[model samples]
Target: MSVRRLRNLLLVLIATVTLILYGCSDEDPTSTSSAGFAGLGQDVDGFQDAGSNSSLTFPADHSAHPDYRIEWWYLTANLEDESGEPLGLQWTLFRQALMAPSKRPEPTPWAADQLWMAHMALSQGEQHQVAERFGRSHSQAQLNTTQNSQAGVVANPFHAWLDDWQLKANDEADNRDFDNLTLTAYSGEGDTRFGYSLTLTAEGPLVLHGNGGFSQKAANGQGSMYYSQPFWQIEGDVTLNGETKTVSGRGWLDREWSSQLLDARQSGWDWFSIHLEDGHKLMAFRLRGGGDDTDQAQGADYRSGTWITPEGQATSLANSDITLTPQATSAVAGRDVPTRWRLEVPSAGLDMTIEAPHANRWMTTSVPYWEGEVVVTDHASGEPLGEGYLEMTGY
Candidate 1:
C-alpha cells in the first residue's frame, strides 16, 4: 500500500479512536498530574526500569520498545503565522504497555496488550484547540505485515504514529537519525478546525538528557530513557479556525519513556525548551515532591537541565545550577495556573522572566494542561531575550 493511503486509513482510525476516547471520559481531564498527583501512578511490577548504563542506538531505538511501560514521541513548535502573529503547536503520541513483555498478549485479532494515545494542539493568541485519541493493539501486531494495527512505530524509514496523526520520514535520507521528518495531524470541524502539516530539518545532533539520556525524574534513582533533537528548522502550513497560513520557525522534538518516572509524592512539573536569539538553547524542568527521604537529596523538587550551545555542546545542569520560580498565575480551565516565571541558570548567565502572552492557552484534552509559547526577557533590564515553549502540569 502507498504511504499516503496508509496515512488516510490511519486518519479514519484516529477518528474512531477519538470518538471512543470521548465516550469513555466525562470526568476531569487526566493531566500529567494524573500520574503525578491524583495518586494514579502506574503499578510498576514486571516492567524494566531504564538503566543508567543502557546505550541508545539509532533507527532501532527510534521504534517502539514494547517492554517499557510508557513512552512518548513529542514535538512542540513556536511558529509565526502568515500575518506575523506568533503561534504555538504540539503533537504527541504515547504508548503504554498494558502488560509486561513476558505476559504480552498474542497477536490475536482482538487481543491487545498496549494502549496508544495521541494529543494534538494549536495555540495562537487567546485561542487553543486540542484533541486526544485512544486505541488498543497487541504487542506483536507491529511485526505483522498483513493486518493494519491501530497504532505502531517503525525505525528504518523512521515513523511514529497513532492513527493518521504522525511524524514520519518524507525523504530518502539514508541517515538513521530520522532527522528529516514531515509531521501531519488535524482534528475538529467547522470553525474549530486545527492542525499542521510541517517539515522539520534537523540542525544539530540529538541531545541526551541527564546522564547520557538516563534522565532521573525523582530524588531516587528512578528515571526514564530521555533524549531530544533540540535543533529543527520548521516550515509548514497551519490550519486554524478554518483558516490556513504558511509559517516558518524553529521546533523541538523530545523522545522519552519509562516504567515509572516520578515518585508518588511528586506533583507535576514545569518543562521549558527556550531558543535564545544569541545562539543558545536552554532545556530545564523541575518535578515536585522530591523523594529526598530516600535519595538523600537536599531539595523539595527534582531539578536538572541541559544548556546547549550554538555548536551543540551540552552541559547538564545540576539542581544547584537551576532555579525556577512562579511569578504570576492565570485562571485557565477553572484552574489557577502559573503563566509567568523566573528562570535562573546563574552558571550560564541566564536570569530571565518568561511570560505567556495570554492566559487562555489551555489544552482541554482528555488530560487538560497548560502549554503555550512565551516571551523571554532579562529579569533586571526587561530586554527581549527570545521566544520558546513552556509546559506546566499538575497546577
Candidate 2:
C-alpha cells in the first residue's frame, strides 16, 4: 500500500480503539462498562475538569483543550433549495484524548496521543446520507497549519478539520475568525455522492449556556463548558445523490468540552436546538436517569437550557424551568425512538409540539443515533411556530 494509505489505515484503527474504550455519549451509548451514558460520567482523575470559576476567552478558547478528555465542534443547518424543499445537514468533529495531559507520549511521527473522528450527514425527506472518518495526532506536536497533522484545530485562524472535511474561517483577518466561516466536506461518489460547501455568517453574538459557559449536566454538578453561535445566515451549494443545488438557510454551531460531562447514573439524553419564527432561539437537553435520591430511584431526568432573544440576550433555564415529554415514538433501526415531543416553557409563555417529519433519519455510523430536522407548532392551535433539530441517543 502507499505510505499515505497505510498511515490512514493505522490512524483509523487507533481512533476506533480509542472511541470504543473511552466512549462518546452520542457515539457509543451501549457500553456496559461506562460510568455514565457512553462513559461521559466516568471519573476524571488525571484530566482537567471544567469548573465554574474558569473564564472563557475568545480565539484562545476556540482551540483544542488537550487537558480535557473530550471535545467537539458541532454544526447543524436547516436549509432550503430554490424550489422551497427543505434539507438538513450536520458536521461534527470529535476529539478523544488517549491519555491525560501528564501522560502524553513524546512528540514523534509514529506516536499518537489523540484520536479524532468526523461525522457528516445530509437529510432530505426520507433520504438520509451519512459518512464518518478517523484520524490520529500527537497533541504535543506543533500544528501551526493544517498540513502539520492529519486532524487538528487551530484557534487563531479558527480551523477545525479531518482530511478534506473542514470548517474554517472564511476570512484570514483575525477579527472575522468565527463570525464569518466556511464549511466543506463530501463523501461517496458516482450515484451516491453527497456533501455541502456552505458559508456561515453569524447574525448574533455567541451565547453562553448555564452559569456563564459552565453548562451543568446533572444534579451532582458534572458538566461541561458550553457555548454556541445560534444565529447564522447560511448560503451555499449542497450536492446529494450526484446532483448539486443552491441552498440557503439558518445554522447553529455548538462548542463544548469536558472530562466528565454526566452523572454516573445518567444513561442518555435528548437535545434540542430551536429557531423560532420571531427570531428567538432555544437550546435545551434532558439527561435521563441522573436525578436526586428520590428522583433517581424513579429514573427521573435532569433538564437545562438557554432562552435567547433575537438581539443576543440570553436567559439560562434550570431543571424546574422547562419540561420535555416524549409524546410519541417511532420504530427506527429496530429501536423505539421518540419522534414527537411536547416542550413547554411557562416563563416564555411557550407551549409547543416538536415532531420529526421524517423518522428514517438514523445515523448508521460506528456509533449510531437518531438526529433530524423537526417542525415546531403551537400545541393549542397547531400553527407552525418554527423549525430546528433534535438528537436522541441511548435508545
Candidate 3:
C-alpha cells in the first residue's frame, strides 16, 4: 500500500532536516528527495525497473527482490469456525531498501541500508485485532546471519520471517514447487490476544499477472513484477480474545516487487481477491489517479487483473477489461471508506456486487488502511456468489 511511501518520506524528511542543521553524518545517508508518492513516480537512480522482457525463475522468485526499492510477501484468508461464523485473517511482510543492490553498504556489524515492517490482523463480527512491528538489517548480511535481526525472507523451501511470526515450508521436500506452507503469527495479550497457526496447500498453479508477471500500474508504463497463488486450501487453529478454536478455509498469496510501485499523482489503490463457489478465482485491482489524459478525463483509473480457472489457467486483463464502482461507504478510522462495490467484467461474463459484512477492517498502522473479508453476489438478483478479501489504502 502506502507503506513504502510513508516510511521513505518520514525517514528522508527527518534525515534532510537533520543534515541541514548538523551536516550529513555517516549514519544518515537519506536526503530530502521525492521518496514519497511523488518520488516513487519519478525515475529512480541505481535500482532496476520492471522490464517487459524480464522473466521469473521458480524458487528464486519466491525468495526476495532486494534489487528493487520495495517488495512484499502478502497473504489473506477467508475462514469459518466450527459453528460457521465467518472470520478473516491477514499477514504481510514488507521490505524497503535505502539503496539499490550494487550500492549495498559494507556489511559491518549492525550497519544497514534496509528497513522491514510487518502487519498482522484478525477480524470477525464487530471485533478486530491488529499489530505492527518494524525492524532494520543489512541487505547482504541480514539474510546470511539471522541471529540478531527479527525479520527476513529465504528462498529454498520458501520461508518469510519476522521474529516468531513465520510463513514457511511445512514438509522437508526439496521439489521447490512452493505448494505447501505453514503460517504462524500472533500478537497482543490477555483478553485482547489473537493469532493463527495454519497450513496452506496449493490446489492450482501459480498465476502470473499482467504480461508475464509485469503488472503495469500507470498508463506511462510504471509497474511491478506481480504474481499470485490464489487457490490455497487452508486448515488450522485460531485464538480470539483468549479463546482457541478450530478453523478451516481458503487463502491467497501475492508477491510483488518494483523500484517504482506507482505514479506520482496516484493516490492509492483498491484490490480484491474473490473465490467463487463454482471454483473460479478472480483477482482485480484499481490504481487511483495518474492514468492517461483520455481515461482521466472520463474518471477512469488504472486497472488490471487476472481471471483464473479452477486449473489455474489465467487470462490477463487490461484497464478496459473491467470496471469497479464503489456503491457504499462506512466511517472507519475517522474516514469515510468504501466497504461496498459493484464489480463487472463484461467480456468475462462477470457482473457481481460485493460487500463487506464487517466494515471495520481498519489497520491503524504507521500507514493506515482498511482490509477484511467480503461477500459477492449477483448484481441483479442479489443472490450470494462467493466470498473473498478486500484491501483499500490511502483513504
Candidate 4:
C-alpha cells in the first residue's frame, strides 16, 4: 500500500477506536447503569429521534442515515454444507455519528463525522471464528470514481461497504434493488482465513415492525425504525480454516436505526429471528428493563415482536402478546449468558424452546455480545420446529 493510503487507514482506525472506547458508551464497558447496553440509551440531545410518524422509503432507506446516532445493516444466515452439517454466519456494518448534525466538523479529506465498525463471524460445531474492522468517513463526503471513502453506503444500487467487506445489490438479478443481493467478506490469511461469498434472493417481502415501521423499544415510547427481510434463499461458498464448501440455506437481513433506541433504565436485550419449517416466521425481543410499571423492583421488561406469514403478511405482537423466559445459562467469557430460552406467542399458537447448540458464540469485539444460531423445538413434545439465530446482550 502507498504511504498516504496506509496513513489514512491508520487515522480512520484510531478515530473509530477512540470514539467507541471513550465517547460512545459508559466509561466502564461492563456497566449498564449510566448508559443503556452499549450506550444505546445514552443522551440524544441533538440527534434525530425515531418516531411513530416516520415513513420508511425503499432504496433510500437501504442506505445509511447519518442523522441517526446509530444504525446497522445486519445479515445472518443458517446454511448446510454439501454433507448437510449446519453452519451459521453473520455480517454486520454499524455506523455511529461522531457528532450531531449541527455539531459536525467541516468536511475535509482527513476529517470524519462517522465511525464505522464491521463484524463478521462464522460458526459450526464448536468452532467459531470472528473478525472485526473499523473505519471513518465524513457524512457529506462526495462519491467519485477515482477513490471511495474507507467506509460508506449508497442507496440507488444499494451498496454498503467498509474496506473490501461488502453487501450490495446483485447486478445480475432481475428483482428489486434489495430483493437480490450479494455479500462478500473475508478475514485472516492462510490457515486462519474464514468468510463467505453468497447470493441472497428474497423469497418474501420486507416486514416492518411495530406500527408501520416504528418499533417501540420501551414503555416510554423510545424506539427505532425496524424491519426485516426474513425469507432469503442463500446459496454460495463458505470457507473455514482455508477449506471451502458449497452451502445453501436461508438468511435474514435486518435494518434498524435510531438516535435513542432505549430507555435509560433499560440494560440489555434478548432478540430472536426464527424461520419455522411450516412457512411462518417470528421476530421477538425482550428489553430487560425500562417500562411503565414502577411497582416492580427492577422495572418491567418491555417486550414486542412480529408474527409473519408465508405470504408476507405481518401481525404485531405487543408486550402482553409475547413471553421470553431464559431456561438455561452457560459460563461464557466470564459472564452467565442465557443459551436456552422459551419463547411463547399464544396469539400465534406458538410455544417453542430455543437453544443454542453451541454456547461459545461470543463476539470479543470493542463492544462484545453473544450471537449464534439456535435450534427451535416444540416446547412440550420436543418435536423439531425450525431454526433461527439468537442474540443476547448486556448479560
Candidate 5:
C-alpha cells in the first residue's frame, strides 16, 4: 500500500482500538474510562514492549515522538503593565496513550491508542481564566482525513504549534534564525472569554534538560526526554474583559515526553521553572505519594533540572539542593489549587516565593490540573526576583 494509504489504515485500526477503551464524547469528559458510548474494553492481549534505541537528532528530533506513549509542548510567559505590575500566560498540549496498538483485545470501529489534550490560561492583576479540550484519533483512517490531531516541529520552517495557539518563526523573508515567532489563542463566550495574539523573539539558545534530554523521573528508571527554550523576548496584544492591550515580556517553552509520567504510587506533583534576574534559569519539582518522603517507591521524591547561564553553560541540579512547598490553596474550575509556593536552590544561592498573577488558571483536561504563569520574589527579603511558570498535576 502507498505510504499515505497505509498510514490511514493504521489510524483506523488504532481508532477502533481506542473506541474500545475510551468512549468518544465531543463535549469531552475529564476521566479515563471511555464509559460506554460504544467500542471500548472489548478486547485484551499482551505483547513484547518496544524499546527505544534511536539516537537523538536536532530540528527533526525536536518534532514528534509518536513511537512513545506521551508528549507535550508547553509555554508560559511573564509580562508587565505600563506601571510595571506583573501578568502571566500559559498554553500547553498533552498527548497520552490509552493502549498500545498491538494489545487490542478485539477490533471495532473508532478504537485506537491516541488521545490529545490542550489547555490555555490568562492571568493579570487579580483576574484569572482557563479552558481545556480533548479528542481521539486512529493512527490511520479510511477517508485519509482525521479529527483534532495536528502538532509537530518543522526544522526548516522552525515552527511548533497545535490547533490555534502556535509558535512559528517568521522566516519567509530572510531570517534563518527562528528569532521571531507568533503566538495566538482565544476562548470563552460573550465578554467573559478572552485570549492573546502575540510575537516572541529568541534571546538565547535552547536548554536541554537532564543529561542531554534523558530526565529521570522515578528510582526505577522511569523518566522522560526533555528540553526547553527559556529566553524568548515577547511582544503582542492581549484581550481580556473585552479590553485589548499592547504587552511585552519574556516567555519559556518546555517539551517533555515519556511512556510513564506519574510514578504509579505517587498521587501528584508540584513543579516550577524560574528565570532569575541574574540571567540564570532554575527548575524543580516534587512527586507526592508512595511513602512518607523516605520510601523510594511511595514516599520517594525525585527532583532535578538544568541551571542555564546567559553564556549557555548548564549545571545539573540535585534533589538535596532544592526545596518546594505549597503555601496556599484557592478555588479554580471547581477544584482547590495550591496557587502559592516557596522554592529554594541553595547551590544557586536562591530562595523565592512564587505566586500566580491570578488564582483561577486551571485546565480541565482528560487529567485535570493547574498550570499557569507566576511571579517570583525573594523568600527572606520579599524582593522581586523574576518570574516563571508553575504546574501542579494529579491534584
Candidate 6:
C-alpha cells in the first residue's frame, strides 16, 4: 500500500480503538472528580497548576503514582542490523488514571479504574511497522498492589515492568551492576509480528532533565516529571520483517509522569532524541500553542532539550538555539502529518535533517499520534550524522 493510504488505514484503526475505549467506560461523568477534568484526566484530585517544585527523590519517586491521572514508561533505541543498516525501535507504556481512589466501583472481585496502553514500532527507510494495545485494571484487584502495581520500579533488585515488557537485573547484590539486565518486549501476530529480547548494561549514570527531572512543558507550569538513562549499553536480537537478527546499539530510556501534561492552548508537540557522532546525545522538543497571543507574555513556540556529553554531563538547549521546520506533509493515521523536518541546534554546532524511516508509524490508541525512528544527517556537509527517534503529536 502507498504511504498515504497506509496512514489513512492507521487513522481509522486508531479512531475505532478510541471509540471502543470510550464505550468501555460507562461510568457517570458527574460522579468523577470535577468538571473540565474529563476522561483519563479525572483520576487526579485537586490538581494545582504546574510550578517550580523541589528536587525529586529516587526509588520512591521512580515508582508508580496511583493518585496521578497519567504516567508512562517510554523507551527508544537507534540500532544497526547485522549488515550495518540503521534501524529505529520504540516501546512505550502509558497509564491513565480513570477515577479517584475514593470512588471505587464496588468491593467486587473484578473492578478497575486504571487504563493502560502500549505501543511498539520498527522503522527503516520508507518502511514502518507499528502496533498498539490497551487494557484496564482495578485498584482493588491483584492488578495493582498497594506497595507496587503490576507496573513499578524497585531499587534493590533493580526491576521495572508492565505486563509482558520488563527490564530487570539477574543479580541482587548492591555491588552488582545493572549491566547484566534482561529486557523483553513482544507483540503482533503472524507475518506482521515483531518483538525483542535484549541485554542492557548501564554504560553511564542516569541523566536528569530540567534541573533534576522537573521538565517544564508550558509557561503556566503544566509539565511532566521527566528523566532519562540515555547511555545504555545494549545487545540482543529483535524479530522483524520475518527475521531475527542479532543487533547492538546504544539505547535510551525515558521515564515521565504528571497529572496535567498539557496546557489548554497547546495542541501537540514535536520531539527529538538523538545520539551524535562525537559522543553526545541531544533531546529537543517543540510545544505547539497560541503563545504570543496569550496574556502570559511568552512566545507560542516552546522548546527545550538536554545535551549529554560522553563524559556524563548535561547541558540545556534553549529555545533560541533550536529550530524545527517541516519540509513536507504526509497523511498519517488519517491526519496530514509533517513526517519530515529540519532540525538545528546552533549552540551545539549541529544542523541536521530529520526524516522518518517510514511514514506510517502512528499508534492507534486512546490518544493517537505519529511517533517513530528517524535518520539524522549533517545539513551542511550532507554526511550521515546518526540515528534517533522523532515524535509529533496533535497535528
Quantify how close model 4 is to the true structure by its C-alpha RMSD in Å: 2.5
lDDT tens digits, residue span 1-395, model 3: 49766655665554345334322222211222323232354456689878788899887888877778788999999999999999999999988776767878788754667767789998889999999877666777445633455567877667788778889888754554479899999998898889999989888889999899999897878899999999899999999999998999999999998888876556668999999999899999988765677645632478888999988899998888999999999998899999999999997899999999988889987667889999999999998899999998767
After the best TM-score superposition of candidate 3, give how far the Cα of residue 5 lies from its true spot, in angstroms: 26
| Tens digits of lDDT, candidate 4, 1-395 | 99767866786677656557534664443234556777787778799989999999986788888999999999999999999999999999999887889989888877888888999999999999999988888988524322288888887677889899999889997754898899999999999999999999998999999999999998879899999999999999999988999999999999999999988777789999999999999999999887667544456888999999999899999988998899999999999999999999998999999999999999988778999999999999999999999988877
Once model 6 is optimally superposed onto the true structure by TM-score, how far is the C-alpha of residue 273 displaced, in angstroms?
0.1
Model 2 collision count: 0
Candidate 6 stretches with Cα past 4 Å from truth are: 1-50, 104-108, 125-127, 138-156, 171-180, 290-299
Predicted model with the maximum TM-score: 2
Model 2 — TM-score against the truth?
0.95
User: Which wins on lDDT, candidate 1 or candidate 5?
Assistant: 1
Query: What is the per-residue lDDT of model 2 for residues 243-288, given as tens digits with 9 covering 90 to 100?
Result: 9999999999999999998877677799999999999999999998
Clashing pairs in 3: 34-39
State, as a TM-score between 0 and 1, how close model 1 is to the true structure: 0.88
Better of 1 and 4 by lDDT: 4
Off by over 4 Å in 2: 24-34, 142-147, 172-174, 294-298
**Root-mean-square deviation of every model:** 5.3, 2.5, 6.3, 2.5, 7.4, 7.3
Q: Encode model 5's per-residue lDDT on 10-70: one tens digit a residue.
A: 6455545554444343322222332212221112223112123323466665555555666
Candidate 2 worst ten-residue window by lDDT: 25-34
Which clashing pairs does model 6 show? 11-333, 50-221, 112-138, 291-300
TM-score, each model?
0.88, 0.95, 0.89, 0.94, 0.77, 0.80
From the highest lDDT down, the ranking of the candidates is 4, 2, 3, 1, 6, 5
User: After TM-score superposition, what is the CA distance of residue 260 in candidate 6 from its true location, in Å?
Assistant: 0.7
